[model samples]
Target chain A: MRVGELSRRSGVPIPTIKYYLREGLLAPGVATAANQADYTEEHVRRLKLIRALIDVGRVSVAGAREVIDALSADGRDPLDLLGEAQYAIAPRHRPGRESPEWPAARERVVALVEARGWLVHPDSDVIDLVADALSAGDRLGVAEFFHNLEGYADAAVQVAAMEVRSVLARPDPAAQMELVVLGTVLGEALFSALRMLAHQHESARQLGFSPPTPADHGVNPAP
Target chain B: MRVGELSRRSGVPIPTIKYYLREGLLAPGVATAANQADYTEEHVRRLKLIRALIDVGRVSVAGAREVIDALSADGRDPLDLLGEAQYAIAPRHRPGRESPEWPAARERVVALVEARGWLVHPDSDVIDLVADALSAGDRLGVAEFFHNLEGYADAAVQVAAMEVRSVLARPDPAAQMELVVLGTVLGEALFSALRMLAHQHESARQLGFSPPTPADHGVNPAP
Candidate 1:
């Protein structure tokens, strides 16, 4: 198929496809002539995946590149694909003073995470990462809050892992790989949006607040 | 009090306090001399809130600024705060593709969302946004997978909204607000992780596959 047909079929435009090819986001099509290139089913599939990462998953071009690389990596475990992608996009920390209470709080989190059977790498920064979030909390009712959150993260890890693996079990490697990305990437945004709404509604009922109006941000503002 | 003392009191470090002031993330302390500034309780409170945004909320400085502006906006309703924050972080759209199917899909979604009693904007984009996701999903065995997801999103919105407003109903508005940010932001991550695992597990059973190995992002070659 010509690039035009590829664009029409994949819904990705010619210019964006050109950019993706130049940026190594997509591999080059076979050159039938000096200015003609032929695409294939794989191209269509890859293009759709790229579209999914960008449009639905909200990943940056760089982030999407990393995800696609991991996804298509030969013999790469899905778990590692997810991890590599996460590590790449993980927020960079500004080095600073560590709180004296940080270690103890970290221990508490470690214990909680372990008890919940999460696979925390021996050197995974998530321990310190979470502890920093806790310490940064400064007794603003976050210690207990994190305590609950740690448990939630544990349960979440289990649930998401299971869901993704189930999809990976599909006989079609294509579908399996497709779900792997969906369950991990786009799935995050979907559930995040859901959790935000869920927590808000629950909080409203318990707090006896009036039905939500448009002006709440003025009173509550972003944290 | 000195910055060190305020650090101890607020659980924010001296350097972070400096960073905050320099960034205008926090208001400056009362000036005692050319090189001296005295910290106050307001500094303590602001410091904690900033930490919440950075660490627990995992919001970037620019995003934090948006939240802060909304929060500081005088005479705004709380509901607006939530909506505005969502707007800031709402999903992005593609450059051009007028697929009529998206609006129809979105209408179904809106009906589902409204049935759950969410305060949704009467905008059409949300439909397009969701249709994009469903369209990208080629492997979700069920034809009405988008509808299923809408149900999920609707339920999530209701639950999250309730949970958040419950905090606002607390006796202390500050604590309520703090918890709201913590719950919504952190809860977003946790819930998504859970959904990922759950969906994987269900998909596996239906596909007749073995359970996935434990969650390790970096590991052995694919099994």
Candidate 2:
């Protein structure tokens, strides 16, 4: 298929596909003739993955490229490649003097890790992210929320264990890589949306606001 | 304090502060002269909140203004205010024909909600978000992960319930609003980071890989 067909098939615009080709984010298609090339199914799949990373994960083009490269690397440990890919696309989090309570927040994170007997790197960027988020909670006057970290950690580890097991069950390395990317990015999205809905339910329950069923509200049944 | 001091105090630029004022996202300072206005500590707090919404939450100026206004509305229900604010900052997700598997995915989400006995509105945008994300998984060849939605829902509800409780416990409506916004945005970040760490631990445990200790790895001790 030509670039036009690839765009039509993948829902990406022709110019954007051309730009990706020019930037070497997408591999060169087979040169069928001068100034024309034939793309295959792999190109369509790659294009979709690229869009997912950039549009959904909000990763920069360069960051997406790096993640793609990491995924494509041969004969490497799956765990390392996945870690690098997940870290590459993760939002950068930095704690500063603005959150004076960050020190206690950091201790809480450390304590949670120790209590959980988890095998995570002591200095991982995620530690700082978790600490910083808790620190921000303190800054915002939700100091009581810190006491619930154990509950959050329990749920996180439970769901994450399930996700990891699914990724490892993939028959091929390529499938495993796809699962890692999707689970890391889209899984967070899935869980966040669920949390939002859950919060809505909890809020309604606490306030005695009955949820209007779709049948009563004339809401569309299909999404 | 003036705009310059507000900038220095909140780490927002003077021009950006003026821009927020011009856009009515931030309340204007008291006029002391034609060219000067006095800002209070409330201005400093409001500036930080604005930055948190824009910078951390990645909310548009217009969206932030709506959320701020909703927060300030007198005699309104906190539950409704929080729902509006969270829904406002949430990333817009529209499922399209490209995700052909969305119908089945939507059914799975409906089933999960029913099974959990959750009281969320049946037609909430989050229902579509969860369906769309799951549909993407189906498109990407990770259909087996859908079977794990129950576990994910379990965790989401557990944490979200705690968060809503914390918000409701706030002594003032203003504090309740702050917790709602902060919990919705930073809480997601916090949980995502925690999930990433949990994935790392699970991967390491499954592969028999030892997590590097900070002391031996020369990792920074402080975040």
Candidate 3:
């Protein structure tokens, strides 16, 4: 169909469609004329996935791009595809460079990390991760910080493994897939919000402070 | 004390400390001479916070900078400070442009969201969110994706609220802060990994696939 027809058929607006073309998020329709272009069913499907990632998953464009590329890669079965998608969204220490002087302080932190025996890679990424956190009030000593994080990572690994094992233990295939769909799609957001709440409450307890009020919008307020 | 002494005291190494200084993640120790510099207690504390954020929280250097600045903002209460930190670590979408060529497809997804009466903001962000997801193999015509995500978000909100309420219900401030650290530091990693497993197992069931042998990790060897 022509652009207008494509818009009508797809329910996306014209100007917005133009923007997608510019962003490389969408390819332009076939040129029927100098000013006209045609779209296809594939376009409709693609547009929907993009929307799902952005609107529901709340991933950024760069993040979403990575995810889409992963999905397009071979070896993904339908049942496992969603699971892979979840991995792409999994949280990790985002890495970037810091000022040169930051490394002196970083080494101190790294030693503490090593002494504590946390399973972290000693990459430049670690430097980027630690460089910006220097100013928070609840500053941890090197020993204390590494010890705390290692404990936390260990606890997390155990809990997550248990939950997943339980989910997979069920016998019914339909239920299993439903669980996967439900679990992968919603599980990250659910637990992420939960963790934030847990953190705030726990931090408050350690600091001898009051736990803050919940957002009450059915959404856990950040922190 | 000298920078070397401060490094020993803080557990930060000299080389890494130098990097932190160059990155602005730390202030320069007071220079005693061309070859010597003195450091102070504040440096030690700041180094710890930086380590926690980078090493534990896994924040990027640029992101950590933003987070630290927010945490250090004068006059903000600790609760508010933490809230800001949570959101900063993972910012939510604002809005973005949509495409006209896929109006029908966009509308299908939007309508699915609207039918649920979701309070989605229509803007460039939302548009890009939808557009990028197109590559994820989600069928635009299928309503299941929207329904699934909405349901999941709802459940997540409820679970999170419960967790927070339970923690806050505690009578002691010390206990509350401890919970905060526990949840944030530990809970985030734990739940995320579980969610990933859930996706993998569930997807296999949905696709009529059998589990691999014990020797085989969940991932296919070919993959």
lDDT agreement of model 2 with the native: 0.78
| Candidate ordering by TM-score (highest first) | 2, 1, 3
Q: On residues A1-223, what C-alpha lDDT tens digit does candidate 2 reach at each position? A: 9999999888899999999998888999999999999999999989988887876677889888888888788888766787788778886545353566887888788777866667766677677778877877667555676667888888888988898888888888897887788678888878988899888778877766654564553221222
Off by over 4 Å in 1: A11-15, A55-60, A76-141, A149-162, A207-223, B1-25, B34-37, B51-62, B73-76, B88-101, B117-147, B150-166, B190-223
Of models 1 and 2, which has the larger TM-score? 2
What is the C-alpha lDDT profile of model 3 across B118-163, one tens digit per residue? 3232331332334323312233333233333444334333434444
Please give me the DockQ of candidate 1 compared with the native complex.
0.26
Tens digits of per-residue lDDT, candidate 3, A1-223, equal: 6777767665667786787777766767889888877789767655655655565465566665566665555654443455445545544443223434455546654554345333233442323333433212123422222223333333333434443444455575433433343334434443454345434444344445432333221222345
Candidate with more favorable, higher lDDT: 2 or 3: 2
Q: Arrange candidates by DockQ, descending.
A: 2, 1, 3
Q: What is the C-alpha lDDT of each candidate?
A: 0.57, 0.78, 0.48
Full-model lDDT, candidate 3: 0.48
lDDT of 1 by residue, B102-152 (tens): 455456555655566554444523344544444444332322223346445
All DockQ scores: 0.26, 0.53, 0.11
TM-scores across all candidates? 0.70, 0.89, 0.48
Ten-residue region with minimum lDDT total, candidate 2 chain B? B214-223
Winning model by lDDT: 2
